[model samples]
Target: MLNLNDLRFFVQAVDCGGFTAAGRRLGAPKTTVSKRVAELETALGARLIHRTSRSFTLTEVGRDFYDHARAALIEAETAEAMVRRRQAEPSGTLRLTASVPTAQLYLADHLPALAEAYPKLHLVVEVTDRFVDLVQEGFDIALRSHFAPLPDSQLLQRPLAREDIVLIAAPAYLEKHGTPQWPQDLAVHAGLLTGPGATTWRLGGGDADEAVEVTPRPRMLADESVVLLKAAAAGLGITCLPEAMCRDELARGAVVRVLPGWTAGSVTTTLLMPHRRGQLPAVRAVVDFLCARLAR
Candidate 1:
């Protein structure tokens, strides 16, 4: 294996003008520094220095080699610094926000580990679907679910999950109401819809350029996803939810997907943070932790 100490020794020798000077700075004997540099040249099968009694100079290849060796040392030092920075225990309040569906399906799963790892780091999480301004709202970071590109802003975005919005209903509901074979048939079933009041549902899929819309005439309406999920599982009516959020329900037969090839579009879960917040160790720790676990 190539020794990193050789790279350090070689770089120091070149910068300090000679092995004797490099050794004084590195707290090693001049002979040891000279030996390490020779080993490096031997490993590469090329001479890196023209040595003499009075002074040493780099050969043509040695000059080129020195540039790369210096660059490598800088990169190695930077990598070590970054690892040390991340290892620093981050402490401070980290204010965060996310849509309800994203919190339940993705963020909730990984946040516990982050909290446990950095007990000194406090978290204040807001769950909502509103488009919150990170700067104006004083939020350090936010998680958002977007169907389209977010409006251009100063915040930075990192994707956490790409969730397909699937329609689901209880088996009892499907058997009693009969499965909808097409998008138009969706109108006939009782709809347990999200958001307040009644509105048309638009689904996009099935090898089509255009989306399909239907007015199911919702018999129940609410803004909460868990409420809708529970209602659908209780044989109330068909509703839309992220497929990942419905995993347990689908597995337990509490709910089954409907309209296999069709979907209520897709949602991208993203982490957003202000540009200034990126420099904070607390924010960096939380962002790194979430990205490591939640990124898909």
Candidate 2:
């Protein structure tokens, strides 16, 4: 019989890129993880890993087995989530990460309610614009906005909110440079762009996605969404930002929307967590709280 725990260790080893890394994630000694893998391979009479002094690579047979092992783990996790769903309450430490603005605007306002509802739940929030390694960073959940879908299946994602990227500028800048009527006019105007994916922004209407390449003058190139927003508000440059990020500013007339007809769609927020079985009560609680709060 295949030991599921050993299979999990194998998957972790592959994901973390080494036996020592897998051991750290599983909180086991490196030798223990190594021995369990060796034992599993011996029982099956097959070589699963192509090991070297510096690295480990999977063989064809190892890849095949990994697929099955990964599926089994996902199913087990789903089952455990079902069980946690039946319980009326949640408790424990919930480590979470999010962009600085989202944390300030959404989570900071909402997480207290969740914590209050579940007194035993302790919430730790890490706010940053940079990508975080969830497992390595010891985070239970992360909230992010991306133009593209997260490409990894090893992390389960739950969509929290649907948002749109709207062109924003101070009334002064629009008056000075004249507002851009179409995507093409953006080339002539001073603009701000978010950096993460590629530097290109997809701008268009309906189902036909149009890619427009713009070279914006950078007083400073901001990697952080909040900083980008502040620059736009100060009338430094026009920017396309998530609607959620600029809601308060738009409402207050600090920044006004431009190019209503020609808009870009790059706004999506999701809760991401490690694809694991038997998440404890506190983790599940934080997930539910975030889903509900963001949904609203």
Candidate 3:
């Protein structure tokens, strides 16, 4: 006979990456979680994971079992939720992840109101710019800005906003170097590109696209988008930033938009959720709130 409790622990362990992390998440001792998973494997007569010192990766059979187990567990929880919903109450901890700027300015700004609306919903937010593994991070939902839908099989995403990009340069830099008159002129001017890829930039003009390869003239290169913004603010070079991120700076004359008519619309913010059936009320409520807020 298979133990449902042990199956739950196995799912959590896989999601969390290691026994220690899974123990912390499940509030159980490492030995206990490890024993349960081991026992499960013994009963199933298959190796579920390939374990190493650094990480534990799922085997082919393990991956297949995890999918079915996750679905079955979620369905069981949903059945319980239906019973709880009959009593009319929403109570659970919601784990959410988002980039620093969006969490600080957009998500956290509106959360107080949502908390007021639903006092039972507890919000735990992880702010990071790095792409987090939803399952391994133990996040119920994440806010991401992607050019398209997420590629992960265990995640589902919904669109939230169509954010546009803008080219920004410090006023002094613009004055010294002179702003580019046309999209093609961007090639000559120094640029502070955000992420490394082929050292090429595509500037959008009305019904036309201009491709420019900008090689910065020996300056500090940063991987963080915020770093590029700060560098641009320090009059380093011209940088492309999301319009929403630099709106205040542009309004305050801290940074000026170089190409007004031309824009490369690439970024988009979306809400990503685990592909679980029994989503806690807190998670659903927050997702709904964000969609409504962004749509408005």
TM-scores for the candidates: 0.66, 0.66, 0.79
**Each model's C-alpha lDDT?**
0.84, 0.77, 0.78
- lDDT (Cα, tens digit) per residue for candidate 2, span 90-128: 655568899877687668888778878888667788898
Candidate numbers sorted by lDDT from highest down: 1, 3, 2
Off by over 4 Å in 3: 1-3, 16-21, 34-65, 195-199, 207-220, 277-279
For candidate 2, the 10 contiguous residues with the lowest summed lDDT are 211-220
Clashes of 1: 0
Minimum summed lDDT over a 10-residue window in model 3 is located at 211-220
lDDT of 3 at 48: 96
lDDT of 2: 0.77
Best by lDDT: 1
- Residue 288, candidate 3: Cα error in Å is 0.9
Clashing pairs in 2: none
Candidate 1 residues lying further than 4 Å off, grouped into runs, are: 1-87, 128-131, 196-198
Ten residues in a row with the worst lDDT in model 1? 73-82
Query: How close to the true structure is residue 164 of candidate 2, measured as C-alpha lDDT?
Result: 81
